[model samples]
Target: MGFLLLAGAITAEVAATTAMKYSDGFSKIGPSLLTLLGYVLSFALLAQTLKTVSIGTAYAIWAGVGTAAVATIGVTFLGEGLTVTKAAGIALIIVGVVVLNLGGAH
Candidate 1:
C-alpha cells in the first residue's frame, strides 16, 4: 500500500515538473495550475507514503526517481541534449536509489 502511494507521488511529481516546463514562468494559466495541483497532490501522497515506508527510503526513492524521470523527459521530448556526462549522471542516480533501497531493506 505504501509503495503504491509512493508510486502515485512519484508520478504526480513528474507530471508537475513536466508541466512546469510548459508553464512559461507561471504566466501560462493552464500549465501553471497543473503544476500547482500536481505538486500539491505529490506532497500529499508522499506524506501518506511516509506512514509505512521509512523516511530515508521513501525520500531517496522520491528524489532520485523524480530527478531521473525529469532528466529523461527533458532529453527525449524537450529537445534537451543528452551528453555522455548527463547519461552517466542519470545512471548513477538510479544505482544510488537501488543501493539505498537495498540497504534500507535490512
Candidate 2:
C-alpha cells in the first residue's frame, strides 16, 4: 500500500539522518555507508508511493512529518539542545502534517 511505502521511506530517512549524525564528519565508515544505503532505499520507496498518491499532498506529509521526527530524535537521542524557537517551529510542522492528513478526505 501507499501508506506502507511512505512509512518505510520516513523510517529510512530517520535512520539515515540519525546515522549521519553519528558519522563523525564521515569518519565512521559503517554509519556513513548505512546513511547512503538508507537514503537510497528511502527515495526508492517514496517514488513508488508517488505512483498513487498526489504529488503535493504526499510530499508535504513526507517532508513535514520527516522533519518533525528527525528533529525530535536529534533533541532526545543525539543530545542536541532545543531552544524555544526551535521547539515552536517543530510544533508548527507537526500541526501542518496533521492538517494535511485531515484534508485527505476532501
Give one clash count per candidate, in the order shown: 0, 0
Return the lDDT, model 1, position 17.
96
**Model 2 score (lDDT):** 0.88
Model 2, 77: alpha-carbon shift in Å?
Answer: 1.0
Q: Encode model 1's per-residue lDDT on 1-106: one tens digit a residue.
A: 9999999999999999999999999999999999999999999999999999988889989999999999999999999999999999999999998887777651
Best by the TM-score measure: 1
**Model 2 ranges with Cα > 4 A deviation:** none
For lDDT, the strongest prediction is 1
In the range 8-98, model 2's lDDT, one tens digit per residue, is: 9989988998899889989999999999999999999999989988778778877888899999998998789999998999999999878
* CA RMSD per model (angstroms): 1.0, 1.5
After aligning candidate 2 to the native by TM-score, how far in Å is the CA of 75 from where it should be?
0.9
Candidate 2 lDDT at 46 equals 92
Range of the 10 consecutive residues with the lowest summed lDDT in candidate 2: 97-106
Candidate 1 Cα lDDT to native: 0.95
